[model samples]
Target: MRFLNFPFLVYENILKHLEPRELLLFSFCSLKTRTLVSRMRHTPTYTIFILDKPEKMSYGFVEKPEKEQILLSWTWKKIAMESENLDNRTRLKLKDVLLDCRVTFHRKLNIPTLVCRCEDVSSRKRFATALHSHMCEVFHVKPEMQFKLSLDYMDELPYTNTVRDVTFLQSSVNSTVADEFFEKFHVTRALFSKRCVPDRLLKHSCKFLEIKNLFVDWSPWLDITLLLKVKCENIMFSSSTSVANDAHLIMDNFNLEAWDPEVDKIEYDEPVHDYCEELLYFLYDIKKYMLRSGILRRQSDGSRALDKTGSYCSS
Candidate 1:
């Protein structure tokens, strides 16, 4: 009997037992199948992530049960499969575009991944974008997408709405490129960078901000002032050296009265230093000021400002 000939209950039961990848492939069978799969109650919501270097899209849950969290990955590379079974290979159509895909296990992630070998880079980008749109519609989930890419692939930047968080993986980014990127995409959620970010980029507001090994452009005071202008709920700053000095600078400039009320946590890390008395005093001073100004309600639990031995956390 044809698969669609089955009753609705039987169809749902079969879908419930199928893996995420299999269900995804089944959705491509026809419009009827796609709607059925999409309306099913057992469908999983995923956080979609896109990378440009190898040109891949990965989707997974953010929570625990790490084994089953990462359901599937799609890439344009021609990866060799562990099993040579011909059944693992198939061709799927995404709207007008047809893709040749093979089921394979990711060596490092230990998750099922689909590999599609496109003719060239342009075709790969089109396929990835089309598939991403298809998944978003079929899954009926809010666009919670993250993009990790190097500056070299700036020409291939995706639509602005599809990118909520951005991580620049380039070793170094010039001011011009950084200015162009910020001008193009206004990332609203989080911004992460390992390289030095220009002051203009730092002025943009986000929900979360994290920078590693950040060097002061002019001085620590100027850097702190720029960071203060960013309206974020949570902030983390780390440096390999001069961390203590940075902490002091932050304490001096971080005015709780002027801080965004939405902000709840602030953390700073320096690998080389322990909890110094001066740092503790600065933290206490901030806490006392917050208490006197009625900015902080809880006075007894002030230890959270300098919570760790080597790091500072204020909540």
Candidate 2:
């Protein structure tokens, strides 16, 4: 059967019925076939968002971009959701996969976070490289695949020319693992959970990073000023009561020593509960600043507009 000669509408219907993997395979048959596939309204519709974990390889397909997320998991045993950790998205017990090494949300293009169970470094490298090559060929895409590695398994990283983005999730096992992973693969971002992110890793991770976005959660007492040395475009912190005390809304703005954040690209959600007079002063000042900055501008409906310069405030 000459699939190339099929009527465009017929091809569309057939393509629509194909599974995500089959669609990917069909897209790369020939030049004419590729063009026909690309012209079918949704060119790169079905994409694998997260495809990791060793024995229990977790993979998924996306029919709709953001709202509709369908997860397809493969395991030696049936999977089940057993518990929850509401305070932290990262801390959420995503199944009982314990041997999994690294969990990173690569900031390069916001790649899907991987929960990998590949323990041996050599096995991890081979599996990751094979999968990366296969996916890139199937999707007709460049090598922008992202993988997260820690100091423990740093020696296992493959030296292939795959455009790899590695993010080191600061772990409690040992915070000083940057030395093991940073020199090998391209380590881009670091997600901080607690206060024990060793001084060396924090200091070294940013020194050679090409791109950085710092994510801090439940680390209210984290020294905001230390970030000054770290070159980053954006910093995100989730305010929550931790061991140190109340979330002080730490940011580059905190170092500015002003009641207001004084920067356009800042995001602040109203504190879960008020901390003290200092917190009140901080919020009031930012509110006044936001109003004064955008009160003159009007939305399509003539309401005062904000976020012109990246100041996103939620009550």
* Cα deviation of 156, candidate 2, in Å: 7.4
In model 2, the Cα lDDT at residue 68 comes to 26
Which parts of model 2 have CA positions greater than 4 angstroms off? 1-11, 19-54, 59-127, 148-172, 188-211, 238-315
Residue pairs clashing in model 1 are none
Worst 10 residues of 1 by lDDT: 212-221
Error of 2 at 107 (Å): 32
Model 1: per-residue lDDT, tens digit, 10-36? 888999898766777688779999998
How far is each candidate from the true structure, as Cα RMSD in Å? Answer: 9.3, 13.9
Error of 2 at 136 (Å): 3.4
* TM-score (C-alpha) between model 1 and the true structure: 0.58
Scored by lDDT, model 1 comes in at 0.51
Native-to-model Cα distance after best TM-score fit, residue 238 in candidate 2, in Å: 5.8
Per-residue error at 115 for model 1, in Å? Answer: 3.8
